[model samples]
Each structure stands twice: as structure tokens, then as C-alpha cells.
Target: MSQPGVLLDRDGTIIVDSGYVGSVDRVEFIDGSIEAIAALNRAGIPVAVVTNQAGVARGYYGIADVEQVHKHMIAEMARHGAHVDLWLFCPYHPDGIVQAFARRSADRKPGPGMALAAAEALDLDLAKSWVVGDSPSDVGLARAVGAKPLHVGPAGSAVDNVDTFADLAAAVRFILGDGELAMVTRDERPVKFPAARFHRADSYGGAYVNELARAFATVDLEQVSRAAKILNDAHDRDAAIFACGNGGSASIANHLQCDHLKGVRNGTGVTARVLSLSTNVELFSAIANDLGYEHVFSYQLQSQARPGDVLITISSSGRSPNIVRAIDWAVANGMHTISLTGFAGGAARRRAHVCLHVDSTNYGIVEDAHQACMHLLAQYVRQSRMTPDAVASQTF
Candidate 1:
């Protein structure tokens, strides 16, 4: 019989995420990580380190550098009497800068290529195995291979409905079935975002522009792609896409209605249907005055939204009561939920099916990024229906 094994994520799980760690000198193992591996080794369970090395594809480092670091890792573990049966890393990304490594590969995290290879090489049973990591992609990799998933991150990081641990040691204990190490439940509270990034700049223009560029770099293109697909699906089915937000986010939500409706319909084959819950002042004021302020969006959703419609909520803090309520309502009613969140994505981020998160603490930066996202999605969906020649010739 093939034996059960464990698949472990490298950075942020077994070691600290020092950002594209390419050299052995920067390898900093997490506390208790060595002991945790030793415990697994003692139990006669095979372990494999499966990681995504996007740095290699991004031209930050080469495959040789990655291999050297892996070798260093293996040596470090050996000195401590722990053994990792296999080491696997995926070095491909669709938007990578290195031509040799740039392109999509099934070996990437959330893809089953590496897991399948490890299972075969190690004579293991994936159905009985555990995949532990600190990111959503790690959980996704587990699901893709039918393995048990354990998250190792903060109290409320966005990958929902999975077993979470404070660190790798705790996750290891759970995998070993230690009775004292009970699984930790997610707090589901709003996480605190970092301090302001542009406050200390020498000049306003330079600081603001640089901060915006940095924040934009952290935006997940994959999440945006998923959200675009959802919007397109709704458009194809002739379902209304509802948008809501408050203050600056409200403006973005209102703008979304314009771009998604008129902007996407001009040359597109489909007629887009969109509504902004934040735009109707008379009805919104009545709902806030009568029912409650938090009921503004949900109340509208209940009356107009259908099962297959889409809800897009924009919130800088992501914890606005009304926004959270609307997302919950839409999800419960079978409508697709997408959220644009910044400053430690809160309940709305967690509840939404797709979260386009802006990793900025400043409200202006977040709102600016959200506006760009709205425009990108509208244009993408618009051009998706047009011929390449027409798209090239037409003004956006």
C-alpha cells in the first residue's frame, strides 16, 4: 500500500518570507521548523517541499541559484537529524521576464503537476496526505490534489474554510494528530494594515507616484482575472451586475456602473446590465433612515438582485457594516460576490467569492487603484467581444 505523506510549502511556511529569497545567506528558518521536521521524520512519514519559485521566472534569480538554496536547505536539515524525502519547485509564470522560464506551467502552485510527480516518486497516497502552506495557492494546491489543507498565516488571511495555524509547528502537530494541538478557528476580524508608505517622501508628486507604483505591484492579477470572468459570465447571461460602496469607494462603484454598462456595450456584442446601489439617493436614504444604515445595500439587493446576478462591493477598509451585509446577502442568495478591498481585507474580502485586494494603507492610494481596476475590467470585457483589428483601431 502506498503510504501517506506530507507536502510542505517552503517560504512563509518552513521559512520566513524574505521576498524572493534567492541566496543561501538569506535563508532564515522559522522557529521550531527544524524540530517539527524531526518529529515528522521520527514518525516515518515522508515529507516533500513543494514551492513556487516565481523569482526565477521574474529574472530576480536563476534556476541554479534556487537549486543552490535548496541544497543548502537540505544540508541544514541534515545537520539537525531531519530528512526531507523530496524537494520540488515550480519556476514558471505566465508574465515572467525571463523568456526561458516565462510561460504557464502545470507545476505551479494550485496546479497538480508537482504533487502528482511527488506522489509517484515517493510512493505516497495523495488522498491521505496533507498539504500545508501560508497562502491561498497552497490551499488551492491541496484541493487540486485531493489532499488535506492546513493554512499557516495570520488570524484572518483570506483563504477561508480551511484549518489555520499560527505557524508550521502548530500545523505539524495537527497533522500528527496531537490531541493538545487542536485546530485554530479563524477569528474573522478585520486585520490591521501597515502604516502609511508615502508620508516620508521628499516631494508630493514623487512620493505619491512611487507609492502608487509599489501598491500596484502587489495587486494580484489572478484575482482580477477571476473577477473579470465572473462579470463576463453575468453579462453573457443578461444578469444585472450590482455595485456598492461608500465615500470615495462609492464614487468608484458609481463609475463602475458607467464603465461596465456603457463602456462595455459600445463595441461589445453583448448589452451590459449594471446598477449602482450607491447611486439612488432617494431609495438609499429611505433604507438608511427606515431600516438601518447597514441595510442600505442589502435592502436593495433583496428587491432587485436575482440568483445568477453579480454583486461588486468596493471598500477601502473592507469592514464597513453595510458592505459586509451586502456581500453576505448576495452570497446567500446565490449571486456571485466580488469585492475590491484595501487596508487589511476584512469580512467583505473574506466573504466575497473573488477579492481584488489593494495592499495599500492610504485611502487615496487604494481608491486610485480600485478605479484603475474598474477601468481595466470594463475595457477587458469590452475588447473581449471585439475583433483584434477592431480593438486595435478603436479608441478606448
Candidate 2:
């Protein structure tokens, strides 16, 4: 049997909820949160954060913001002798404006996706673990995974039949046998990438473009539709679209800006505001010289971006630090994010709200597909807004 652990929530449980918190300055840690985790850490218990970041789907923020906040949270916890072993967030919400995430996801609270995945990865014994949060979903999650539930806050008082605590300190005390809580045994399963076979395949570019096309066929259309809706809605709301990338992806980002700002405007008269982070050589050099290369795009975003802006990141490998950092800052400020990536679809692929991924080995194939994705969104928004009578002759 695996060891026990604690699955904790984010907003309102460990941290005070400020309605879609995006910036690092806004992360307010709940009283005793750090100490409670420290208590668990001392007991050799594994800790995992399981929360629903619906803001990512609602266009209030992006997943990069979540990652950045979690990073900050971890650093703060470490200072107090606590460590969170796992992090799981479900960005999807049924009523979200971003089409890609506008559906029910198993990872959402009241569902066991996060707990189950963490359990499998860490070899956690669910029967011995505890679900700690401030909502009914938290209790429901415990039931789903066969873990004990510790409902926190006054809201939990309304719940009929579950363990309740006034705060983390109290819960930890009770769980500790004297005062508060729990624990992991881990499974070492390596990440397997069968898609890597495209690199070794026989024929033209290893028949890579064909492989890319085939892989794209499997992408969920709901995600694309969600992305399209995010773009169009941004256009309607007169929001800015910030795009970032590196190398060929940089060119693609710039080209995407042109298409969204010009093509979409010409086609739909929506006048989408677009900017390319790959541009602004002067400020980019200044930041890269002072803070480091990764700060260039993010610094610009921190100063210029406002809530409800859109971020479009074209990172063929999805691992570029600068690109990822830009997305991180943008999301924290309530920007809707779209990522175009390839290969194993690195961090950006997972962090962005809308992911347009081309699974292939060749850079040329990935960039080509990314370019097509940009055009697809620009044209999609244009066509959606155009008159029915103009649809036939307006597009090629």
C-alpha cells in the first residue's frame, strides 16, 4: 500500500480569493497555510495542490499565471519548511468564454482526475490521504478518490456530512493526532513519447509534414472553436492581442499580428489590436542587458498589458523561456492565451488556455503548421463576423 498525502485547494483555502488572482502581488496566503504544510512535511507526508483555475477558461487569466503563482507559493512555503510535491489545476469550466476550455473536464473539482493522477504518479494510498478545501467539491473529491475529506472555512459548515475545520491550523492539529494532519510512496514511470518515431520514419522529411497533418487530425475541434471564440470576442471587446515567439516562431508571431490586426479588420471591420513581443528591439535589449533575456517580453507585458488582453505565443518547441515568461505575465493580468507548438508540446502547450499543437519532429513542419493555425484564427474570426451574403466570395 502507498503512503498517505494531503490534496489541498488553492483559492479560499490556502490563499484568500480575490476573484481570479493573476499577479504575484495579489497572492494572499491564508493564515496558518504555510505552517500546516510544514507540519505535514515534517510528518513525511506528500502535499499536492488540487484546484480549479476556471479563470483560465473564463478569459480572466491564463495557466501561466497559475504556474507563476504556484512557483511563488512554493518559494514562500519553502521558507516555512514546507514543500508541495505535486501541482494540478483544471482550467476548464463549462461556462468559460474561451471555447477550447468551455466544457466540463474530469480534472475539475467534484471529479477525481487531479487526485487520481497524483495518486498514480506518487503511488499515494487514497484511503489514507485527505482532501482539504473550502467547498463541496472538495468533499466530493475525497469521496471520489476514497480519501478522507477535511472541509475548511465557514462555507463548509453548510455541508451536511464531512469533516470540518475552522482553518488549516486547526485541521493540522486534529490530523496530527495531537493537533493536525498527514503522507507518499512514489511510482517511477518515465514519460514515454511514441511520437518521437516521426524523426526516424522513412521518406521525404521523414514524411514529416504528412505525419504532422495526421497528428493534427486528432486535435479536438472544441479547443479550436474555443480559441476562435476567444479571438473574436477580444475583437468585439476592443482588446489588444499580444503575440510572442523566437526565431521562425518570432516571424510567425509578427505575421500573426498583421493578420489579426489587418486581415481580420479588413474582413470583419472589427479592428483587432495586435502587438508582437518579438519587436521593440530597443526595450528588449535594455531588459535583456539588465534583468536577462527572459525578462524582455515579460517586462513589456508587465508595463503595457491590461486585463482582458489576448496573448498568442508561437513556440515550435514550446520551451522557450522568454516566450513562456511573456505568456506567464500576460495571463496574470487577465489575458486570454493561445499557444501554437509542436514536438512534445512543451510548457507553453500545457500553459496556454488555447493550444494549437502540431506533433512532428521537423522545425519546418511545425512552423508551417503554426503559421496555418494563425491564419486559421484570423480568418475564422473574419468569416464568423462577415455577412452570410459575403461568405462565399470573401474567403479563398
Candidate 3:
């Protein structure tokens, strides 16, 4: 059976106090919240947002306004380097000022409606999930689903089922444990480093390099082929392919753009429509400034990605919040996702439609293998569609 997971309250738990936050300008994250959530993500625990927005019921804001605010919140978290897997909200209030929202709804706080809905929608094991909030109602709702209810802020009168935390960071630390331990399994096989190499600095470095190389060598060529086929099929249907990564992986995104968009059908004249989300630094920074970083990829996916499009994500650790959020969005929207990852499978792997895993924990090895996979896909596509002249030119 899978382990228990984490659910978070958005307003006061993750973000600081903001009454009925309806604008991006109003959203501010609690200190260490991003790191805490990221740690949870690394541990393969799904992190969701459960919030009560009484503003909707009060007619102070509409559903769209609430969604926009959430988008801003997500964007901010992304900028800060955390990802929210799912967001569940209750807009109803029994004492709502608006007649339309005046009735008592199961989705309202103190009830488990939204949490239950999130459980069903996200395929979560409610019994193993935790809900972190700053209010008694949040605690009650979590307990209703048999989930762990952790309260943030000052120790309140002890509730039977709730655990009190000094802050969000403290709660997250308890839930995620230490960040030093690697979580998730990328490849089924264990990686071995040579003991002799460790004795000599130079030899150890070389051995480390060699081990990485060997790890890259294990990336299945057939899987690359299958991924190429998927991309090709998508191309045939005139669908878009979106790629994302960070740092070195971001470079890989550019490389993939060159290969998939330009190199694939160079001589054969077949063009695969592709875009690398990491390319535009200006837009990224702008969004980070205006919206926040976490939403950089997700917002793009929401705007540019269509149903049946392909999303290819690259990560050595397989635990980037932005990438995971993008994958989550893709999955929710019925888009296909291909994940290239190292270390343990991470959240991205579990959520991906197809995962190309690199077994090694060493980043260099994983990156190398990712590059090789990229090359293999490009070369295979090129060769498959090569004309007589193109083949002849390659022969000599």
C-alpha cells in the first residue's frame, strides 16, 4: 500500500493572512512554505490545496475571480519553487450574502465535501492523506475523511484528531522528513560505485564520470523509438509538442527543439510542431514578476496546450515543482506527458503518461543519458524518413 499524503490549506496555512484574497498582488507565501512543499513533493507525497473562500458566497468575488487568485497563488509558489498537485476550494457559506450561495453546501468547510471531491478526482487514498490548515473547520473536514489533520499557528485547544504545528514549515518538516534522503526509484536496478576509485581523488572522479556514462548507456533505445513514434503521430495530427526543463535540462529543452522541430524531417520535409517552454527568458521572468515562478510552465500549458498535445519534461532528480505542476496540469487536461528523469521515479514519473528513467543518482550520468535519448529519438526519426540522397550522403 502507498504511504499517506499531504493536503494544505491555501489562505493562512501556505500563504500569510489575506482575507478573501482575490488578486495576485494580495498573495504572499508563508516563510519556508515553498521549501516545505517541495520536500513533500520529493518524498512522492501528493500536495494539494484545500481552501475556504467565503468571498465567493459573500458576492465580494466571483468564481472566475477566485480561480484567477488561485492561478496567481500557484504562479507565486512556482516562482518560489513549489508545486501544488491539486487545489480544492469551497465557495459556499450558509450565511452567504448572495442568495445563490446562501444554502448550506456539502462542499463548505467543516464538512468533507471538497476534500472528498479532491480524493476522488486525484485518485487519492484519503485515509493516508493529511490536511494542514489554520482553522478548526479544516481540522474537522480532514477528520471526516479519516485523514490526518495538522493545524498551523499557535497551539489551540487540543482537538481530538488534529495535530498542532507552530508553523507551516514545522508541519511540512514533520511530514516530509529530512531532505537529505533520496526518495522515489527511477530504475529498478541499484547503481554501484567502485570502491577502489574512492581511494584516489582523481580515480574516484574518473570512476564517477564513468559510472554516469554507463548509466546513460542504459537508456532503452526502444523507448526512445516509442517516444518518437508518439511525437510523430502527434505531428501527423497537427498537434503541438511542449518541452520543459531547468538549468542543464533547460538546455536539453532547446536541444530537443532543434532536433524534434528542425532536425527530425530535415530532408524528408516532415515538420513536427514543437515549442520549448524554457526558451523565452523574458516571458518567464515577466510572469515570475507578475504572477510568480511556479506557474511559469503551468500557465503556459494552460494557455498554449490543447487536449491531445504532448508535454515532454526533463529532470535529473525528477522532483522539480514547476515540471511536476506542468505534468499535473497536462494529465488533468487529457494531454500526453513524457518524463525523462533520474533518481527515484518522483512525482513526475507517477503522473506521466510515459517515463524514461535513468537509474543513476549522479546528475551527470542522468543528463548524459537524457541527451543520448534525445539524440536517439532524433536520429531514428531522421533515418526512418531519409530519402535516397540523404541516405547516400550519410553513407560516405
Q: Pull out the clashing pairs in model 1.
A: none
lDDT per residue for candidate 2 within 153-213, as digits (tens), equals 9643646787788877667666766412321111211111122122223323423433445
Best prediction by TM-score: 1
Compute the lDDT of residue 387 as modeled in candidate 2.
Answer: 84
Expressed as tens digits, the lDDT of each residue in 95-202 for candidate 3 is 899888877888877788888778776678889788888888888888788988888886664556567887787786666543432222221233333311133465
Question: What are the lDDT scores of the predictions, listed in order?
Answer: 0.84, 0.78, 0.76
Minimal lDDT window, size 10, model 1: 188-197
Q: In model 2, which regions exceed 4 Å deviation?
A: 1-206
Please provide, for model 1 over 104-167, each residue's C-alpha lDDT reduced to its tens digit, 9 standing for 90 to 100: 9999999999999999999889999999899989999999999999999768774778989888
Task: Please give the RMSD to the true structure for each candidate, in Å.
Answer: 18.5, 19.1, 18.7
**In candidate 3, residue 105 scores what lDDT?**
82
Task: Give the TM-score of each candidate.
Answer: 0.53, 0.48, 0.51
Q: What order do you get sorting by lDDT, best first?
A: 1, 2, 3
Model 3 TM-score is 0.51
TM-score for candidate 2:
0.48
Q: Predict model 2's lDDT versus the native.
A: 0.78
